[model samples]
Target: MLDSGAVAEPFEREWFMRHPMRVAHDLVGAMLVVDRNGDQVVARIVEVEAYGGMEDLASHATMYRVGRETIGSAPGVLYMQRSYGLHTMTNIVAHE
Candidate 1:
């Protein structure tokens, strides 16, 4: 766990522009800090799923219109997905 005063340096826009697999590697075992309203939440990264783009059959880009737009857009696009018939996971689009 991070100390209450721990400060994280935000990554540059170029960082997310890399291929999704590389980003996934960088995310493993890293720290993620999120601040919403007045609450701050910190979590450790374990796993990630990467999508390359239209060529990636499993990517949203090949499934729907919005998928093409969002997945092809900049790196920080957010979308929703129902995983394993269990829960909906919020997804952030990252691609080169």
Candidate 2:
């Protein structure tokens, strides 16, 4: 059992090597940790959407050249793109 205020161990890279659908489902409630310039930021992952490459028609990989490159690249690469010309959406390449 974990004590209150204790943070869980970070997930390993292998955790993301699984199929995207599994990754998305498992990510719910996980904590996202960001360390920048010695400052740490942590947030709870509340939602996620999985996009299967090539086989998924709704995936951005099917519609954009950038998406294809990003998805095809190695895992952990951040695929950052503008959403609907407004919000910036960030995704991580998975299943490499």
Candidate 3:
């Protein structure tokens, strides 16, 4: 039998602590705009991937800590990085 009032495990606490945005709750439908040197671009954010901080290989967290390195142009904000040295890709974040 298990104790009903047992405290959450470390990993469980960490998981719960993660501030993830639900795809359906936050971004089922939304628009995104990008402007570079007077070039205006626009599109809707249809998909996203959440990297749970530094541990995630697909996240900037591993590369550097928040508010420290110039992580990239989109620090802390979710965005896609190009892959295979090919064409541009797309992504989004739950940053406010």
Candidate 4:
């Protein structure tokens, strides 16, 4: 479990209820704070990516059944992906 007790604020919750493109744009410069094993880890969100819905051919939600369901989950849910089995990427859900 995260030691920081990560919880969404009202403003952040509002942001998550919008379209992915909007959320992606607004997320730039945002801080991602996580408490890893009692150590605070912080990172700035310099880059953000927004994928079209399940119909988009390039979207994971379109290629995998699990991704489809995951993208549709409640806002603020964290989604993670592995890149070429080397790098780990993270995403947050935004639904209108």
List TM-scores for all candidates, in order.
Answer: 0.73, 0.80, 0.43, 0.78
For model 2, residues 1-96, the per-residue Cα lDDT tens digits are 224587588767777788888888988887767899999877777778899898899998899888987787766566678878998766877783
Candidate 2: residue 87 Cα off by (Å): 1.8
Q: Please state every model's RMSD to the true fold in angstroms.
A: 2.5, 3.1, 14.6, 5.3
Candidate 3: lDDT over CA atoms? 0.45
Off by over 4 Å in 3: 1-18, 23-25, 35-39, 58-60, 63-80, 90-96
lDDT tens string, model 4, 1-96? 344676654355666888888989999877787888899877778898888777778877886665787987888888787766798888788879
- TM-score for predicted model 2 compared with the true structure: 0.80
lDDT of 1 by residue, 2-96 (tens): 67696678766678877789887887876766789989787776777787788989976697776777776677665776665798655666777
Model 2 poorest 10 in a row by lDDT: 1-10
Q: How do these models rank on TM-score, best leading?
A: 2, 4, 1, 3
List the candidate 1 regions with Cα displacement exceeding 4 Å.
3-5, 64-66
Query: Could you give candidate 3's per-residue lDDT for residues 30-70 as a string of tens digits?
Result: 55556799996656556655554445576755653541232
